[model samples]
Target: MATSSSTLPSLVVRMLRHGRLGPGLATLDLGTGAGGLAAYAARRLGDQHVTSIDVDPYLTEAASERLARMGLRPTFHAVDATAEIPGHYDRIVCTVAIRPGTGLRTVLGALHEGGRLVTTLAGTSLILTGWKHKTGELVGCIERGGAEFMLTRSGHDYPPALSELFAVASDEAGDETGTGRYPVMDVANAWEVRSMLEITTPGVQSRYSTHDRRRTLLLIHADGSWARAIGEWTDPPTVHQGGPRRLWDALERIRGRLNMEGALPLYGAHARVTPDGVVHLSRGQWSGSLGEE
Candidate 1:
């Protein structure tokens, strides 16, 4: 089992301060893993006021022992976070990744008006602090940097196996595949694009690799469409593409536009999250969304 990183304590503390947690603010640490964040918050705000909870009794016991070593006694509860949260809290911080339809609306309802909730959506760690702008929108931005956390264990670690969706093709056949090129905007800095697509687009994964002897390879996907490119500059790139859509061509067009404009901006892109965790992206007149099997 991997432990939460040591830097998490200070990171959580900074997020707390960013969210404006003061001397009297009530704090709840959800998924308190080894009690690292709990202990750090307790020391910062005093143990009597911090409440820590986890679904696993063993994790609770380990957190208890860890807190004891720090000479801090924060209340620890063994309860399923997906079910019900004990009481309303001024600030709720979760150290686990939340999937779609995990009762996030219920958890958000538990926060007092003007109270803030900080947690990870999918796998990206974000700090959302809003004053309940109304009934529907809880608007916030991604915290300065990114943080990684483990998923809660309500079931087995690995999800049930997925049915085979594609047949493997020979390298020779794959090499002869049709290719297209598009000018791609700088997506590396676009966290929103990455997070939204990962959530909405099933089977979509990306890999970024730079070779010592060649240009970098940035791969993007969804279902059958696969796009691969070499080098960051120069058009008519070496591209190997296959599938339903000419994905490499789409990428080339985006890249060409980026080169024309001198830069591609990701913030101008629009994102929509479906109830089923699918993400749709639209920019200017071009748009695409994730599809299910």
Candidate 2:
């Protein structure tokens, strides 16, 4: 069900602004969906300075033809971005979200020293924009604004979601049951909470639904962790959690912090991505890391 979509023009402009595109700089339009970003960069920076890449050959070929018709022809490549990117770039702006792994490392490795990278982390709306530091880390801050993008993939489709766990969570009783401190919410719609949760506890999939005056939220992790909550719209839900961790409790902790502090540490946080693909984020006394040992 997950498919790539063209980024809106406003967002394309926003990403380019964060990328800091300028004259004569070699730029790579990563994830050249619909070629909007590629067209803009080629027009301003000239076609020779702009290169666009996509995992799908069809997209690469189609976009190449369409942009050529528009009198813009940036270099186009059909390759898996997570593997090995062909060339170094002064500025890399990815329209797709990437998890912290080989894909992220590939993007980081393709940047020249002092180059800038603007992309979102997969499964979260956190837009990370940073410059390649002398020490090889990408150091910058998470933008106060957020965006949602389709995750980058190596093939025709994304990996399957944790549907089996979702099925179990829906029917089975949990090892622990209690009343929640907060009302049952569509966690995916609560962007900051969802983003912070993903940072703290990755690989969790969330599903939410409502019926009459009731609402239900389900969280399932690939590690066999699961949580289910059902209650009235404005009321705290009865929560059930099971497996290696209490998923509901983890979410409640994040929610409690948000209520206590009035904001999350994710937004406007200082971020550092090491050469090995680990991401470290800090905001004042609160700190978190992803893909760490």
Candidate 3:
């Protein structure tokens, strides 16, 4: 079975808080890995009103056994979350991120009008919440804080990553060579920067490493573009990029904006998820989207 980890208690509480779960309300605890969220909800709101589902039958079955021993028996199901859910819910709190197109639409379709949904956007750590409206739209804002969660899968295992492209990025001396203004930093560890990059330039895979005093950062895209930057600690790196686009330049521009503007426009921005599953984000004069129009 695919590796599954339980959601931390602190994060579970935070997500449940945003869900505003209450007694007599039917809550769907999506991604029931260790059944942490399901257990919490079943206790507070009666097990009959809580339903937990996961793609892996092992996780759901194990969680069911444990929760049963604890005197809680919320409904459990082993199913693909990206497909149609079985029942409507007053509140749907997903422990996994949902891709911004069909997966999102499936979840929203399972929510009753006036219901609420909380889930992170795929490719980002953004915590997005929305209230089901009579117009078949979900209207809400990106909350201030964020959480990293695995994306929903339709099968027993996730698809392969861009490992070949990553390998090419590590060795290629490309069409353009230059020096970056910012030092080589671990993009994976910088949540805000990484999240913004995913929002603006979706599907950019990154790898970072250090050896002795030398640090390197590599970025690769599915479109055959790749960039490699290497430098000593705290100093700007020599950048090498090849492909259809200059990937390093894009990262620098994002870094430059953060250095110049002090913040990104993702968090606290108003988010509107249409029935078509497009997420439109707007903050003041800036705007962005997760899926195509």
Assess each prediction's global lDDT (C-alpha) against the native: 0.57, 0.91, 0.91
Query: Which ten contiguous residues of candidate 2 have the minimum total lDDT?
Result: 97-106
After the best TM-score superposition of candidate 2, give how far the Cα of residue 141 lies from its true spot, in angstroms. Answer: 0.8
Off by over 4 Å in 1: 1-7, 100-103, 123-127, 133-137, 160-193, 199-203, 207-293
Q: What is the C-alpha RMSD of each candidate to the true structure, in Å?
A: 5.5, 1.0, 1.2
Clash count per candidate: 17, 0, 0
lDDT value, residue 6 of candidate 1: 40
Q: Model 3, 95: alpha-carbon shift in Å?
A: 0.5
- Residue-level lDDT of model 1, residues 1-293, one tens digit each, is 45332436676666566556668778888877777778878888888878988777777888898889879998898876767778887787877765434445555656676677676555333333444334433444345455556655553243432223222211213433443354233344455544444433434444545545344334445355655655554343456555665444544455566568764433334444333333344557756543332
Q: After superposition, how far is residue 83 of candidate 1 from its true place, in Å?
A: 4.2
- Give per-residue lDDT, candidate 1, residue 76: 92
Error of 1 at 149 (Å): 3.3
Top-scoring candidate (TM-score)? 2
Q: Give candidate 1's whole-model lDDT.
A: 0.57
Model 3 residue-pair collision total? 0
Score every model by TM-score: 0.65, 0.98, 0.97
